[model samples]
Every structure is written in C-alpha cells, then in structure tokens.
Target: MAFASYPSLRDKVVFVTGGASGIGATFVSEFHAQGSKVAFVDLSEDEGRALSGKLAGSWFRRCDVTDAFALQSAIRDAAEALGPITVLINNVANDTRHDAASVTPEQWRKALAVNLDPAMVASVAVYPMMKQAGGGSIVNVSSINAIWGPGHMPAYVAAKGAINSLSKGLGREWGPDRIRVNALSPGWVITPRQLELWLTPEAEAEWSKLVALKDRLMPEDIARMAMFLAADDSRMITGQNFIVDAGRL
Candidate 1:
C-alpha cells in the first residue's frame, strides 16, 4: 500500500534504536524514504551494518540499549554523523514470555531495563539536541499487551504500562519546549520473530477473530504511524497512546 509523504520530514535527522530488523527496520526505511537522515543502533552488528549499507544517508552503530553508557554514546555518535536528532524512535524491546511465579528479581530488572529504560535514557540524551533544533518529536513504541493485561510475561506488561505513563509525564514536561512525546502501541504485529515463534496457523486464525480489521498488522503499519507522529502533520499531538491494533481492545 502507498503511504503519504510528509514535506516537513525532509532533511530531518532521525535516530532509531533496535533498527536492525523487524519493526525497527521498517521505521528506519520509512523515515529514510521520507528524505530524513537516519541513524540507528542495534545489538546485531551484521544486520545493522547491512541495513545501513543498503540505505544511503543512513548510519548504523552497534550498542546495547540496556547499557546506559553505550546507549548515550551511540546517540552522541549518531548526532555527529547526521546533525542533531530532530526525531527519536525508541523501538527496541524483547517480549519473551515467562511465568510470573518463576520470575526472579534480576529477570524483572532486566525486563524493565530492556523494554523501558532505554526510551527514557535516549530521550534525555537527545533532549538538548531536540531543544536546540527548535522542536522535535519522540515516538516510543509500546504494545497492546500492556492494556490487555496478558496472563504471562508480567514484567513485559509492566514495562509497557510504565512507558505509557512515562510518555504522558514527558509530554507534559517537554510541551513548553515544543518537543512532542507520544506512544505507539501495536497489536499482534507479524514480524519475523513473531512468525517464527507465535504466528502458527491456528494462532493466526484466533487473532483474525479478535480484531475489527480482517488484515493482519504489519511492521509497515506501525512505521506509518511513527512517521505521522514524527512529522509536522501531528504538530499538536502529544501525551497520547496511538493504538494501531485494528480495534482490538
């Protein structure tokens, strides 16, 4: 499907985390297609390098988002490569399911660190850059799992819920600076990992019965929402959770 182009996105510098593959990769590609200068970081060196190589005017850095120092350093390097970041996409996450009863303290901390901390860290790191740019947009990729309160993976759900709250708080704090903060919560996105681990024929059949729309949610669908949030087209939108879940509530 054809997507709309945003004139304001042209020449903007965008930094994306977890952009080596899946939904994050779509974010990088879509933003680049809109004429934005893109810089992305991921733990997968080979995938990151290959993606960057394929996209002109894009840079890739290897960094683990859970490590604050590494994440901050990568943001700095991205800024040096592509001008100050005017758009930030916090898209990295791991949604590995686990029994709540068996979750240890370390596991819980790791879950939050991976799914939530980096968004805050990256936002803080780029705050000055965005302010200096006169204004910017931050799109935090969240999930519908938070709202649904799924039985398993308590930590993952908790992190996403916190992200929703964080987005609202940050939005209020940064509104005066003209920096918009918003959350994009997706539902049942059929990424490579999901296809491999969860999207069995039977599972797909069940998911189809859950949403209002018949079509499955794709990475591109989420990317399009990110593009809208990042562009001037959504200049007044902030502190809100935009759920692209095909009416799954």
Candidate 2:
C-alpha cells in the first residue's frame, strides 16, 4: 500500500535521538525515504552505524543522552556535517518498570535524565540554527503511559508526563522564532525493547482488548505520525500532543 509523501521534506536536515533502533530507527529510515538528510544519535553504536551505512546520506553518532554535554556535542557535530537542522525528534527514553516504593533519589534523577533532560538540551542546541533558518519543527516523543499512569513505572510515568509539559513550554517559548514544538504520544508500540523485556502474551492480549483498533501498533505507525509532525505540512501546528495509539486513548 502507498502512503502520503511530503514534498517539502526533501533536502531538509533532521536530527533524531535514540534513533539507532526501534521507533527511532524507523524515524531515521522513513525520513531518509522522504529525501531528508537524516542524522541520528544513540548508545547502540553497531545498529546506528549499520543504519547509517545503509542510507546514502544518513549520519549516526553513539552518544548517551543522559550526558548533556555529549548529547549537545553530537547534535552540533550532526549540524556541522548535515546543514542546519530544520527538524528535531527527541525520541530518547527508558521505560524500565520499577517499584515506586523503592525508587531512590538517584534513580529518580536518572529517570528524568533519560526521559526529559535531553529534549531540553537538544532543543536549546538547535534553537539558534532553527531560528537562523527562519523556522523548524520539534517532535518530543511522549507515551500514553503518561496518561494511563500504570503501576510499576512511577519514575517513567513522571518523566514522560514532564515531557508533555516541556513540549508545550518550548512551543510557547519558540513560537516567536517560528520554531514549532509538539509532543507525539504513542501507545503500546511493540518495539524490540518492549517485546524483549515486557509484552508477554497475556500483556499483549490485554492490550488488544483495550484499544478500539484491531491491528497491533508498529514502529512505522508511530514514525509516520512523526513524519507529518516534522514536515512542513505541520508548520502551523504547535504545542499540541498528538496521540497515535490506535484509539487506545
């Protein structure tokens, strides 16, 4: 089946975080397919490099998002190689299940570091470039779990909830400069990480029972929404949280 195409995306430079695998990798491939020059960073060096090698004009760097300096450096390096970034996808996150009762201060800080800080850091790093380019789009990858607030993931839920707010805050702050910011909230996408550590048959069955749509969600499903958000088609859209979860919300 054929999908929509964005003629405006051709030749645009896109930067994605946590983009070596899962939905992030799909972001890399899909944007490249749209004729955008894609550059991505992730901790998974092997997958990142392999994906970069597969795509003719793609760039990849292995950087831990938790390290603000490293994350900023990678973004700068990508900008240096590709042109000024016109699109930013803040897709880095770790949603490991943990007991709320047992979460230490350090663990809580770490959770925010992984899920929240990099978005701000990357956004700040790209602000001047986007401003110089006259405008840009920023997609903050959020999760429906932020709304669902399920048990065993207190830290993740908190951090993701913060991301939603951050998207709005940045949107308001950057709108004057024509920088659009919005959150993309996905529901229960069965990426490799989810399938490996969670998503047991029972969990899958339970999720199936909840959503209105019959088909399971895929990385491409989420990435397509991101494509629209990143493209000029969404130029006037900002500060909104788009939920792409098969009507699960």
Candidate 3:
C-alpha cells in the first residue's frame, strides 16, 4: 500500500533517534500523520524543540546518541511522557564521508558510536519494556554503502555493515519476545544537505543511471517503508533488510 494509505497507528508510541532533520525528521512527520505519538532525540536543540512543539503530541529531547547516559535518560523520560513505546527507529547516523587513510581512531569510533551503538543501546533499552508491553518493532536505518561501498566513506560503510548485522542478530535473539527487528538501507536520497554537498549535476546524472526508477528516492519514500516496518502490517518480517534504493544495487 502507498504510505499515506498505510494502516492506522493510533495509540502507538514511537521513539526515533536523530530526528531533528533529514530522513529522521521525515519519519517523525510520517508517524505523526499515522496517528502515532512520537518521541525523538537530536543534538539540534532549537530544531528539536520547535518540531516537537509543532507536532503537538510529540516529544523531542536534546541528546547525542553516542552518549549512553543521555540516551537512557531521554528514552526513559520520553516513555514516561508517551507511555510504553511500541516502536523504536534507530535512524541516527554519522554519514560524513571519510576515506580509510584519512580516518583517525577517534573518527572511526565516533562513526560506529553514531551509526551502530545507538541501535544496540535503544533496542536493548526497549527489550524488557516491549516484553512487558507485549511486543514492538525496531527498525535500524542502514545505508546503501553497506551493501555497495562507493569507496569515499570507509568508516560509514563499516558502521552501516555493523548496523545491518546487529539488526539481524537482535532479530534472532528477540524473536521469542515477539519484538521485530529489521533494517532499512536507502540509496541516494536528495536531502538538502546532500543536494548542497554531493549532488552536483554530474553526480545526480550518475546516481540516476544506477537506479531503474526515473525519480530519486525522497525522504518520504524511505519514511513510508519505515512506517510499514513500525506498523503491525509487517508483523511477520524480522531480521531482514529492506532496500529503498530505487534499485541502486
């Protein structure tokens, strides 16, 4: 089904990471439209607070997902405010392109901390809660680089590969609890930052050539798939990675 016509998410509480802007913000808006009470964390205090206010039923907390204590506190407070979260979207990622030789040890750690640790921490935090609440869904946002590394971002590719594996491992471990875990890997989506930084006319033309679809994958396109995974419609799907790449691979 099309995203707008997807199943109702009334009474569901969804927690999203890095949700102040880009694809994460798109997920927040889409979930709100589905009637879910959304809670999200982001480093951008102003945008986070403003978006929270704009989305009346949603809550936004200023947090760096790399910080375990902050993430725990934010999740706990948001759960208290919105009730037991029925969905967790591990959408926080550090996609700053860096080559292997250029990446320092600290930079590599930061990349994994941002792209992979948040999923583990958030999913683990929600485990007992979801078990007590009956069941829920966890969607880890991976990247096309994980499947097809383009060479520019070694750390990003490594981190995303870890995310995909982590999702699968958690899915198998948590299947007994009825908590679904999966990954969503998107291709060259035209976010504002990407358009400004990466999408030169030549880059756009090359990216388009890789995809079968004439149109590029938008934030909404990825958000729609995320919503499906978050909802009960995909109850039986777990330990799987869905590529919303417009056939980039």
What TM-score against the true fold does each predicted structure earn?
0.98, 0.98, 0.97
Cα-based lDDT for every prediction: 0.94, 0.93, 0.89
From the highest lDDT down, the ranking of the candidates is 1, 2, 3
lDDT tens digits, residue span 73-95, model 3: 89999999999987999999878
lDDT of 1 at 12: 96
- Candidate 2 lDDT over 45-113, as tens digits, reads 999999999999899999999999998999899999999999999999988889999989999999989
lDDT of 3 at 144: 82
The worst-scoring run of ten residues by lDDT in candidate 2 lies at 190-199
Alpha-carbon runs more than 4 Å astray in model 3? 1-8
Question: Which has the better lDDT: candidate 1, or candidate 2?
Answer: 1
Candidates' RMSD to native: 0.8, 0.9, 1.3
> Which clashing pairs does model 3 show?
none
Among the numbered candidates, top TM-score falls to 1
lDDT of 1 by residue, 1-249 (tens): 666999999999999999999999999999999999999999999999999999997999899999999999999988997799989999999999999999999999999999999999999999999999899999999999989999888999999999999999999999999999999999999899998898899998888889899798999999999999999999999999999998883
Query: Ranking under TM-score, best-scoring first?
Result: 1, 2, 3
The parts of candidate 1 lying over 4 Å away from their true place are none
